[model samples]
Target: MPETPPMTPPMTPPMTPPWTPFALFGALAVLAWGAAALDAALAGGRWPGIVTGPLRGAARELVRQRRRTVMPDVPLVRAGVCALPAAAVLAAVVLPLGERPVADLSVGVVWFNAMEVCVWWALWLTGWGVNSLHPLIGGYRFVAQGLAYELPHMFALITAALGAGSLRVSEIAAAQRGLWFAVWMPVAFAVYLVSAVAMAFWGPMDRPVGSDIAGGVRAELSGPDRLVFEAGRYLLLAVAAAAAVPLFLGGGVGPALPPWLWTALKTVAVLAVLVWARHRLPGVRMDRFTRVSWLVLIPVSLLQLLVVGVVVL
Candidate 1:
């Protein structure tokens, strides 16, 4: 009894340091950059040639010369169109995970907004550069569509940031440790999701890529140029989903698995949903979409922000 010693509590394993995300992000950045650059350089100027070259000899023998269709505006549109997706891939590289790197940056929300705005610029340039009527119309339509959705989207985002009392995305994610913003601000989440689909021109919101009329903005592109746009769409969807994970679904918050894996899985799942919707939903008319965006989506998003403010206080 005299020799009996007090027993100590069992030790718990140490949580992985948040700094590990930096290394993971760096690797992702390098891979994305290399792929994007290679895609741009090879496909921008010679896309049609790249696509039809092998078939040309066979086509010459089987078809009349009059059947040959000259591919249009490969150089200009290709160069401009390649830049945004390239930048998006680059942004994905630098975006912080698990934690914010520079906590004191005052304009963190501004940074995210700026990046999102670039998506429209990149898309517009691609359409305009094509020097084709269909794409130009598509580009113009994109601008109009953007006007309809961007304000509401920004309001929702700003409300969340303001309510959380931080511009930092990491901080916003952290604030939802006890309860996610989606739970409290369900309307904002819904508005954000709808706007995100519209902004990316995906699925039912895919008026810009209308297969029925004008064949959408990317109708004229071929070869690697077409590939770039196609790939860019996927990347945009992936990035949007990734951004939303932290904002709504509780980023990397799970029982098992590391944080980074959880983030990747969530992003992939969102992309899958977009893909499914792309096949399932019919595209809406541009006029109808615009009206819905302004009349319905905007007011709802604004109200959601007000709700968030009340809950936060």
Candidate 2:
């Protein structure tokens, strides 16, 4: 007789159905529009104009001429142009909408981190591909900013994972049912938010694309390329804001509405804050931010990690 196979649990269908991947695209579109409209509103644009502003810009770019620099690396330019939004989508794969993510990986936090790292690569490539002095400086600026923030960003994520005693995003969210991590782990939460801005190059952390450099990395881009690049920037912002929900805002634990709704509200709130900061706060100088990140943010984030580790123990 054949040896008996090892005993195994029977397979079971998942209780909660996840939204289709297209929903991810829809979320991206919504986020892009919101960022654009709010940016316009903050810039003193009125209601109807603010609402249609993003669409009009897209249309304008569609018909406009594409700019090219001498000796431009076309392939590298395309890679960088596409990377931002792609990274955002992939990073969000592990973030649950209502307690279940699109990917639901065992190491969702790690997955998210990996995707975000890709963004630095994307920006640097875009900057270098253009073969222009301003864009090149812009690219290096992003690298410096990344060095400043990536450590603290990683520590913040680790703190959340340690607090929950798991890397699965949903598990992290579930662990917060009693109390939000943001309450006790405020340091990490705050650092995470700040790093989110840095990671997306948004608002006060947007030195890479600052006015001083005349749009910096994207200065040479125009037409459809510019359209895609702008959309990708907002996409990264949206992903950063959405991740904060599962990482700190108690995921989907609100009383009145469904988990997905709660997640959406929290995400939108975070997104609004990130976008508002663009107008509310002047950008930080990279030189100062570099010092602050290593001296202050890193230490605080590490301490938050220690606190979470002790709590778990």
Best-performing candidate as measured by lDDT: 2
> Model-by-model lDDT, in order?
0.65, 0.90
Candidate 1 — worst ten consecutive residues by lDDT sum?
Answer: 61-70
Per-residue lDDT of model 1, residues 1-313, tens digit only: 6587687543332344556555544534433333333333343536555444434533443443221124545556766568657655544532345543223234555666666677777767777776676777787777888788899888877877866787766667777777878888888887877777777777787777786646667777665666567667656656665677677767677767876666667655665565566666777777877888888888888888877788778
If scored against the real structure, what TM-score would every candidate get? 0.73, 0.94
Error of 1 at 73 (Å): 6.6
RMSD of 1: 12.0
What are the clashing pairs of model 1? none
Least accurate 10 contiguous residues by lDDT in model 2: 9-18
- Per-residue CA lDDT of model 2 for 135-169, tens digit only, reads 88888999999988999999999999999999989
Candidate 2 wrongly placed segments (more than 4 Å): 1-19
